[model samples]
Target: MERLINIDNGGTLTDICVWDGEEFSFTKTLTTPFDLSQCLFDGMAKASTDIFGEEDLPRLLHSTRHIRYSTTQGTNALVERKGPQIGVLTDSPTLAEELRTGDASAELFDDLVGSRVAVIDADRDLEELSQDIVRQVNRLTTDGAARLVIAMADREKERTVKGVLLRKFPRHLLGSVPILFTWEFTPDAVRGRRVWSGIINSFLHPTMERFLYNAEHRLRDHKVKNPLLIYRNDGASSRVAKSVALKTYSSGPRGGLEGTKALSSAYGLEHVLMIDVGGTTTDVGSVKNSTISTDRRGSIRGVPVSFAMSNVHSSGVGGSSVIALRNGVITVGPESVGAAPGPACFGFGGKQATITDVNLLLGVLDPDTYLDGGFSLDAQRSRAVITEVIAGPLGISLEEALIRMEAAYFERMSTSFADDVVDAETTTVAAFGGAGPMSACGAARIAGVRRVLVPRMAAVFSAFGIGFSDIAQTYEANIAGLSANEFAATKTRLRERATRDMFQEGHEIGECRLEWSVVQEDAEGQLLSEDSYSESDPQPSASAHHAMLTLTARFELPHASIPQAEATEKSPAVSSSTRNVRSTAAQVDEVPVFDLDTQKAGAAGAGPAIVEGPYFTARVPQGWKFDVTVAGDLMLTDTIEN
Candidate 1:
């Protein structure tokens, strides 16, 4: 039996889904930040006991074919500022000053300004600066720097510092140190974005490393030999033991985008708007021709990153948010009850009217019988409160307030979704998350989107993405100054490094390919539309390039060195007022021996089929086709013949 474990964490709820070859099992538990993995264990235990009998539970769980995790830890780290302080090393004071503010290095260093300190590398002798380096390290260590980042002036020498730095600081004092070299962090030629990437890695790597270490240990106790995979914002996964564990932060939402890509490609939907409404927020992204669009700087907790990914926008709208009227206007939420207070509808002491309460009032949600009866909801109490608290205050009838609130919620969701899918003309909305379906059709309507694709086990789709993700790693080597041929060589080297890293994680690769694109734009002040490259290429189309240009131009950009006209052929032309363009490439490789089956069971279960384990069900719609496949992905489509 192919048993797979998938975990999804929402604001108020943590959902677990298991695929046991023959059937699917699911459970829901409160999200515990202190020990998020506890819920995973609890969910796994319940599935084991229910499916294999209490005595056989141990053996069956130990035999789990795959285990995947989707966490919000990195998001929380930035939002709550729980990460340790990071130390940055710059090429020189002038270059360091360029990154002092409005850059990722600033965010990573948290801009303490002359506090932890930055070492200026003025192309001078290292022997002369050994003592100064030690002093800085000691000062930073005392000031709470748990990690160090070295961004060099030449960038290519980013990896060369290990030999140079160890000689000065010695391995004992900084030997066990978590050092992030800019070359290794982002070897791509663009120095500015490279700095941003390094900063992000340096800032968040420590927290993620510790969190995953604890999580993997807990998983090991369960006798599961399968390693935990960290998901990247670029919609890929790598083993937890890899040097780039910081990529784990992007896993939770990236999985959803991956699922969207898989679904749209299989179903032949070329353009799609994926709305992942979770407990704390609603994330929106667009897929064109099954490709996820991403911004140059990945957005994590409102911070722009150097990495690229599907462009996603996160809003405070979620199932657990307190719903009320402020300034006589119905406000859905930016504040959540989280796991502790939960929602009033959960019978958990939450008095504020939440979106869940509104769902209960509208008859779309049955509080008395929700989640297959694992938790009973009191509709009458919610109705009473909705009437007394919201309707009366607004001087409107119960039905009117309920209608207004629901309309407002959908409107907010739709407007935000519009911004993401603006470039996609023919797009379908794939809805997931706890309350995704309840408002999906309506939200789509308001957003001017036609067709809503609700996958099987929609609420747990993120978990499914986790289960099927590939073990992958990405590296950027800045060859900004390298020629086209040299750039290709750099790409080859990056692929080799990625493969070696994956092999170290016990993965074997059968086939690997590198994807490279040249980025061209005029000088910093020039508009991309005025550039020759932008007028020539058709892939990104004019609108997409325009958007990209608008975004990139906002920041002070560096000149990209590449052969003229080569960029026009290799990459989608982007407009820039500045004639200067940079050459950059990204390489992705898949590890061998991991199996993924994207097929399904022969038939859809009847009556919100309860597969096993916890109280999770697939509420298949009338005339919908459902199945579980080799990839452990649940597929549901409207099969009523055309």
Candidate 2:
């Protein structure tokens, strides 16, 4: 039997799933952020022992056909502030100061205006900037810079600009530099996404590099040779860690979304909502028209940014959300009962009445059979604390107090989705995490969702998504111009770079595609909203002057009627897409895909279905689905299932 293993490191939990042709198993453990591989190996040891026995562990683990992983390494770096001071090289000298601007209403220290790392104008003489580069490098190095990111003003000029940079700082010297270029991170012409990509690379690569290096070394010692395929927020996988941009900070959540989409198909649910509540927060996303939506200008860490991600709303409420009476107001979490002291029921010396305590008080969770009987809970102690802290403060009966607490927590979680998603469509909500199903019913009622699907082994859903991922890598170049041929040439260059990188890593070339993007806007006129007009309320038709790109991968490219610079001159638009356009592959009537049923027959699909593996289940909801058409993507469809 061809065995498949998937591991997902979430904010609060480390999930694992294994498939052995005939059977599947799932496992969940508390995440160890300070040291990630420790948790991975620990979970691996248990799963291996369970399936292969202690004696056959060696061949079983090492000989597994594939081992996939999705981690929060980049998120950790952002939280820990362990990134490098990037020296931005922009096309225009005036754009350098955009980094220093901060939001006025936020308490973020780094968000202060004029707090930019540093900037260098590429328009200035190379000789002058090279000296500045050395000086900046020295200063950043002294100030504990982990990597160096170089993002130019316009990435389309990569070929012409890279030559000048190569002469100034040779690629061999970059071992000491660890440089990231804007074009290299994202070649498309949007200034914001390009800048965001550079910042993520500058800030996260150092930490990821160290953590992955250690993790890989540990795996090597265990004789596992399969290269770890890391997950991206874009729902893709890559092993060329440093070369790509760190846009997929919420990759773990994306995996859960992928799983939900798969499961929804199996249940034949189209429109659905995906809820993943872990230790820290609850992430809610919708699946419409058998696809998940995308956020183009999404914000992360309170930073106004642009990156393609599943439309998700997150709240500071979750399984580990700490419950407390502050100023006599019954409040539950923004703080958590982490793995260390766990909850009041764990008998681990925690005194705080947490969500777990409330769940125990309501009989939603059994003390004797928590975690599939692996861990035991102390119901009496939990109730004692809840009664003393929550019920006593609210002057209500124990049952009433539990009802109030659970209702409030669910209300808070449900409201997050209420404001974002469009209701009145056939929607199904897939719930996971340690406390997901227990709280999902309440949340679903509030969100007006009709049905809820809790898959088998939902606790380790993320790990199952990892097994369904493919071995992949992405390459981009900075290209800015009005010429389609120039854009086409840039695509060719990026593909070549991808090919060279794969060859160096000893990976066989499977399928390759060329993609490009540029800014564009719709020219249609605008229509008035219902509030403005009386009876004939019509949807707005006026297209916003937004950045747009035309991307095609393995698809025929439409000949441009005008040059790229001219195209943008009249039309102010910038797009972020990764569609391949120049491949020899012929366009067919349609493409083939693997759906939930296909995965059960032992094949991964491009449609919605639940992939029930040993350690986890990937619930692929029909409406929130992904495809391989645009190079590859986890796209959200606007078409709601009626």
Top lDDT prediction, candidate number: 1
> Candidate 1 versus the native: TM-score?
0.75
Candidate 2: minimum summed lDDT over ten consecutive residues — where? 559-568
Q: Give a tens-digit lDDT track for model 1, residues 1-642.
A: 657677776656777777775566666667777777777666667667667767355675677755667778777776667766767766566645565555644654454223555675535566645555666667767777777877777744554556667776666757556777876665344455566566666667777777778878876776667787665665555567764645666567777887777777666677878788887788887788878776655545544445665677788888777678788888888887777777777777777777677766654454534765667887776777778778999887777777777778888778758765654336777888776765665566566655566665667767766655555555544333455566456555755665677567565433433333334333231223323223123333223221221111010111111111111112211211111111111211121111112223232322122121112222233344334432333334443443
lDDT of 2 by residue, 1-642 (tens): 557777888766788777875566667776776798888877776677667656355666765765567777777567656566544444455454444345621332242212334555555576776676566555655555545555565544444456665776576754576666666555445565456656665667667777777877877787777666566776666663422436547787777777766665544566767778777678777776657666644556655454556667677788778877788777777887777677888887777777777765554444555665667889887878888888888788777777677667878677756665466356666677666655665566566664565554567766665554544454433232326566456545655665666554445344434343433332211111111211122222223343333232231111101111111112111212112111111321121222222221112232133222222222233343322111111222222333
Give residue 67's error in model 1 in angstroms: 0.8
Q: What is model 1's C-alpha RMSD?
A: 14.4
**lDDT values for all models:** 0.60, 0.57
> Candidate 1: where is the Cα deviation over 4 Å?
20-23, 53-57, 94-97, 100-115, 119-121, 156-164, 174-177, 295-297, 380-389, 395-399, 421-425, 476-499, 509-642
Candidate 1, residue 159: Cα displacement in angstroms equals: 5.9
